[model samples]
Target chain A: AQSVSQHNHHVILSEAASLELGCNYSYGGTVNLFWYVQYPGQHLQLLLKYFSGDPLVKGIKGFEAEFIKSKFSFNLRKPSVQWSDTAEYFCAVNAPLRAGNNRKLIWGLGTSLAVNP
Target chain B: GEEVAQTPKHLVRGEGQKAKLYCAPIKGHSYVFWYQQVLKNEFKFLISFQNENVFDETGMPKERFSAKCLPNSPCSLEIQATKLEDSAVYFCASSQGTLGGQPQHFGDGTRLSIL
Candidate 1:
């Protein structure tokens, strides 16, 4: 079965510290990668996605993710962190839909980031 | 509209009672997906629809869970004989094109508590 993995379960960082969350998928074929963030008491919002060319994809709120095909990884990064950036982050992958298969987003166990001021 | 709308932001139900969740996909979106987020922080895909047709229901517990997406109406997920373990947040998402490559836009989830 295909799966997504986020090695970080919970992370705490001081304000202005750099942030990096690792994400890896098990599938080898073409895949679509996405990073979503859910702030406290807020709905999940898309941070970034990688569909095709250009392995480096930038997203809103100063977030970016690099899709390394060789490693089957799409890790999220931010140069600096703010208290407001504290949230739960999820990494998802949409693997190619095979015949008789439903193309669904396989998700990782979310990573909770707490940015302390 | 870009936002997918979900109704009944919160629900409380007794064991064995029925629970229903509704979702309205963004306009022009053809693929709709339902996911269950348990307390363990893992998302379980429940079902999916492409227009009025069921695209994928492999994750659904067929004996107790049922879903439908009818024309001109909001999609619905219904659970019969709800169990205590059914307490979780359910999210609905939609995408514009085919399921493989399209990015899914999610809605504010419906939190269900089974007592």
Candidate 2:
């Protein structure tokens, strides 16, 4: 079965520290990668996505992710973090559909980040 | 600015009661998906539909959970005889296509609390 894995369960850092969250998928075929963030009491929003072309894709709120095909990973990164960036992050992959079924996203266990000022 | 809309931001239900949730996919989107989040953990895909047809329901517990996406009507998820373990946030998402490589747009989830 296809699955997505996030290494970090919970992370804490002082403000202005750099951030990197590792994400890996088990599928070997062409896939679409996505990063989503959910702030407290807020809806889940798309942070970034990687479909094709450039491996490094930039997204809103100074977030970016690199798709490394050889490693089967698409890790999210931020150069510097702020208290406002504290949220739960989820990595998802869209694998190709089999016959008679629509494509669905395989999600990783979310990582909760707490940024201290 | 495409957005999927969900109704009933919060719901409180008693054991064995029925719970229903609704979702409206973004305009022009043909694919709808339902997911359940327990304790803010990984999202469990419950069901998906392409247009008015059921595409995938392997994750759904068919014993009590049922869902439908009718043409010209909002999609709905209904659970008969809810259990305490059913307390969770349910999210709806929609995409332009049902095939691979389409990023799904999510809606504000409906928080269901079963007592």
Error of 2 at A24 (Å): 1.0
lDDT of each: 0.92, 0.91
Pairs in clash, predicted candidate 2:
none
Residue A85 lDDT, candidate 1, scale 0-100:
99
Runs off by more than 4 Å, candidate 2: A99-102
Q: What is the DockQ of candidate 1?
A: 0.57
Docking class of 1: medium
Check candidate 1 and list the clashing pairs. Answer: none
Provide TM-scores for the models: 0.96, 0.94
Candidate 2 displacement at residue A17 in angstroms: 1.1
Q: Over the stretch B25-96, how does candidate 2's per-residue lDDT look in tens digits?
A: 999998999999998886999999989888888889969999999988889999999999999999999988
Candidate 1, backbone clash total: 0
What CA RMSD would candidate 1 show? Answer: 1.7
lDDT (10s digit) by residue, model 1, range A1-117 = 899999999999999999999999998788889999999988888899998889999999999999999999999999999999999999999856674333788999999999999
